[model samples]
Target chain A: MSQVLVVTSGKGGVGKTTTTAALGAAIAVTGQTVVVVDFDVGLRNLDLVMGAERRVVYDLINVVQGIAKLPQALIRDKRIDTLSLLPASQTRDKDALTDDGVARVIKELRAKFDWVICDSPAGIERGATLAMRYADAAIIVTNPEVSSVRDSDRIVGLLDSKTKKAELGERIEKHILITRFDAARAARGEMLNIKDVLDILSLPLLGIIPESEEVLRASNLGTPVTLNDPTSAPARAYCDAACRLLGQDLPMVIPNDRKSIFEKLLGRRAA
Target chain B: MSVLGLFRLRGTAPVARERLHILLSHERSNRGRPDLLAILRDEILAVVAKHVSVDHDQVHVTMDRGQIVSRLEINVELQHPANGPIAAEREKAAMTIVHQASR
Candidate 1:
């Protein structure tokens, strides 16, 4: 069955778009036909991040409103033929995304694509809800911080109550994808660490992406970190996350950026 | 352990983690569930405190629903104080809270 996955974090700037783009592209690289749908209307950036901004002719809002067909709005990845993007409208707000309209678009995409990944907007509003409405599973993108983790917990409650599967008494699979983790800082007790995040949310771990400059550069260059720097720390983490999602029983590799030879052995001592 | 690590005060992470843990649990308990969970935990601690000096961190009150039954389970680590009217007071409290229905 084609799985619809929503990449969501209730808090903004926690890398929902980045994860959506990165995970989608990585999955596509593995030969699966993936369509990443941007649900963050009025603040669309999936196109820009996925390097399809120039190619975005018709967007998700257009498809939802019947202004354009699903194929017309979907922007295919130039590099990865298996990857495509359904960009969100920049001028129109989420009010244009009616429930029935979104359901039709999602249903059509489901029949054609192997993976329909929705990039949800921040907050518990209409856009966020509709993004996860038809999802078979969810990737709760969370940062290792108090506000992000707490917001993720809020998202979790919504996933259990507000989603289609939840409404039908069916369980929706949820995975916690922790991003921008700074192990050194975590050890110093500067903010919530991996263990703290896992304990607080109590969800199954997906992958831990280390805080790295390449992630920002990829966003700026309109490329996913996985494609931009696949061998880099964060990119590797995303790839691992993708593989794990593919049911590959891969061991979890917590991305640690600290490379100091002395501190490496000490492991949180210098931190 | 590094000598400096041993001397260093617990960092902000623990404080943040503890706060988030309490906040999320309380928030979660409010959705289709009683809002009294947070209050109940505190009240239980207060009632228990009148007799035994219990550490606030040592108590855990949680709700769990199995296939057949949903229960509010309370787990507490009893601190055996050096000296006090512990046994009689505990028995009296237990009778009032748990055994009162029979009476």
Candidate 2:
């Protein structure tokens, strides 16, 4: 069965779009059919990151409002045959994405792809909520910083209270992906280490994308880091994250709080 | 990197962690907390009242984040009526268990 996942961070520029493209490409390289849908309306850039910008004849808004067919709107990757993208409309506002429209598109995507990843716009607004509304799992993109971690905590709150799974009384699987992690800075106590971020977010550690210029170069070249330089640290991290998403067993940066005995012993607490 | 910083006590990360701990705990406690806490206390008191009489003011429901976990600690102070049989014994027994353990 296919899984719908959302890459979200309560704060912008923490790499939701980058993660969406890299993870999707990495999964597709493993021969799994993956489609990354950009939900950041009026700022659609997943196609750019995936190098499918010029091929976009239609967009998510077009498919949702019946302006175009789903096939007509989805842009297939030039490099990876199994990878595709459902680009958001740069001309439309956040209000263009309706709940029912998103649900229909997600259901259709689910039937066709092995993985459907949505790149949520920042903050807990209509755009962000709609992006995560239909997700079976969430990749909480975060950076090792105070503001970013705090925003992620707020997103966790919304994920627990506002999503479809929460409304149905089912828990949506959540994973924390800490990106741009600088080990040297952390050692110097300038940046928050992986442990500090995980302790506060208290979610399963997906993978840590270390600070690297390769990511920036890949985006500038209109390619995902995993495809541009597969052996690089950031690329390897993204690939590991994709594998973990596919149920591969791997060691993490540290002990994640989801498995912490402290939580197990404490049981459920007052919300 | 000062002398105090060498001891790992002055990093901004620690400060941020401390601030987040306080903020999240406060925010968590307020997640439907005011009425929810009252309802939980009343419901728990009602259950205990079925087996043993408990005063409405005797039940306390709290949500806290210790170093270990986010906890919903419930403390029901079971006190015997002053005139009841073995009331003195029950009073002595009550002090044995703090709010840390629950049956």
Candidate 3:
């Protein structure tokens, strides 16, 4: 069976959708068949992020409602042959998805693909819960802030209670992906540090994506940073995260600009 | 003075000390732990009262580090009317409140 990974965050605009796209592209590049499913429903931003917005004929709701088949709804990525996207509906009908229908679709996807990556909507609501209901594992994306971390805690609680694994008494592996990490801000005590976020979330770190202009630039161009600029810092971080997801032991690097001024001043004073 | 001593002195100076005090206070108040503890205490009291009489004064709910662990010492007190036969029923409610608060 394929591994179903849900990219979720209780707070919005924390790179859950971007992480889903980047990780999906990265995993697909490894010769594995990967499908990135957008469960954002009305917002439907993942297709644009994946540069498949123009190719979206049928969406996730159509597939679930039996109006369209999986193959019809799945849009193959033009850049990467192995990667595909199942876009979300533009309609605002919240009741479009049924529980049993979603389960069946996930089961079918599991049989067909190596990795089924679901991009969950923001907040701990029905859209978010249903996206994660069938997940075998989760990437809990969070920003380096108290509100985002606190919201992530709520999502973690939901993952423990609402997932199929949780209902069946099986363990669903969860990893924390801290995105938009500004080392300079962290050094200046403006944003939460990686260590502080880890101490609060207590989940194993999957990746630390630094706040970079590359992410915004790539998103504007309808491409994931990992694919748009593979050599960029954010791209490298996402690649490392993908490797970690495959159970590789990659050494963690403390993003560069996190050196504290106190330490620097002390060193200078000593010298 | 040694460089380390000077650093320590700087760290403990009035300006740094004031900054530390203000920052610590802000962090603590913004943590939202107290609000969560209050909610937990209310929920616990509601559930416990369904089984036995609980001493409200003895209800202790506190957060340590970032986890919410509550202790409720319920002193069951039964009072019978003078005109009726004194009877007490023993019932155990199987409700466990496991609260793990984190941020």
Q: Would you list the C-alpha lDDT of every candidate in the order shown?
A: 0.85, 0.83, 0.80
lDDT of 1 by residue, A136-173 (tens): 99999998888999899999999999998999999999
- DockQ, in order, for the candidates? 0.55, 0.38, 0.04
Candidate 3 residue-wise lDDT, A174-268, digit = tens: 99999988876677555677877776668999999998778988999999878997877888899999999887999986443233688686764
Candidate 2 at A22: error in angstroms? 0.6
> Cα deviation of A230 in candidate 3 (Å)?
0.2
The top-ranked prediction according to lDDT is 1
- Proportion of native contacts present in model 3: 0.00
Per-residue lDDT of A29-52 in model 2, one digit per residue for the tens? 989999999999999889899888
Q: TM-score for each prediction?
A: 0.77, 0.75, 0.71
Candidate 3 stretches with Cα past 4 Å from truth are A254-271, B1-103
Name the runs in model 2 displaced over 4 angstroms.
A253-271, B1-10, B32-103
Error of 1 at B94 (Å): 36
Residue pairs whose backbone atoms clash in candidate 1: none
Report, for all candidates in order, the number of backbone clashes. Answer: 0, 0, 0
